[model samples]
Target: MNVMPLGEKLLIKRIEAEGKTAGGIVLPDSAKEKPREGKIIAVGSGKLLKSGERAKFQVKKGERVLFSSYGGTEVKIDGEEYLLMSEDDILAVIE
Candidate 1:
């Protein structure tokens, strides 16, 4: 991919969940929940502090993370969908 992530941002691809309810019911298109889980594909270098120092990002590439459903901008690269968001938008890293 030619696109590069910058400035403490992340490039993430959302994980596809089972599109069904627990009662063996297949949910409609609109009934699907917003997936909060995803795998991080790329991470920014670091954040620049006010004192001219860079604060490194904690999340790394290939790490699984949980993010807010309302966060991020959807982008398509090379026919693949991805979410571009700041590191702060990530809720937590999934173990």
Candidate 2:
């Protein structure tokens, strides 16, 4: 399914966290933490400014990014998990 975010929103796919610890202990699903890293799946047009000019986005589709842990609404598309959030919720674009 195709998705388009409106007005500075972004669609992201979370990067899976490792299932094992450095000690070789395998972690169960219950012990896993939701990953804060994700890849941009889709991006909205720039935010609208008071002057009617659109603000440019610092990130783009296909870019890997870091976001606040509690940010974004969870969504499922075609059985896959995704995140929808505002650009302000993004902490940084991973280089």
Candidate 3:
């Protein structure tokens, strides 16, 4: 399914966490923590400013980013998990 975010919002897919420990011990699904890193799937147009000019975004689509751990609303699209969040929720680009 195709998705388009509106007004500085972004659609992200979380990167999966490794299931094994450094010692090679396997962890159960319940023991896995939700990953805070994600890839940007879609991006919205820049936010509108008071002067009718749009504010520029520091990040773009397809960039990996780190976000606030508790930020963003969880969503499911085409049976896949995704997050819908504002650009402000993003802390840094992963490079």
Which has the greatest lDDT?
2
Q: Sum up the clashes in candidate 1.
A: 0
Which residue window of length 10 is worst by lDDT in model 2? 52-61
Q: What is the per-residue lDDT of model 2 for residues 1-95, given as tens digits with 9 covering 90 to 100?
A: 89999998999999999999999999999999999999999999889999998899999999999999999999999999999999999999898
User: Which residue pairs clash within candidate 2?
Assistant: none
Better of 2 and 3 by TM-score: 2
Q: Model 1: which ten-residue window has the lowest total lDDT? A: 27-36
TM agreement with the true structure for every prediction:
0.91, 0.96, 0.96
Model 2, stretches more than 4 Å misplaced?
Answer: none
- Clash count (model 2, backbone only): 0
Compute the lDDT for candidate 1. 0.89
lDDT of 3 by residue, 34-62 (tens): 99999999998889999998888899999
> Model 1: how far is 46 from its true place, Å?
1.3
lDDT of 1 at 95: 95
lDDT of each: 0.89, 0.96, 0.95
Pull out the clashing pairs in model 1. Answer: none
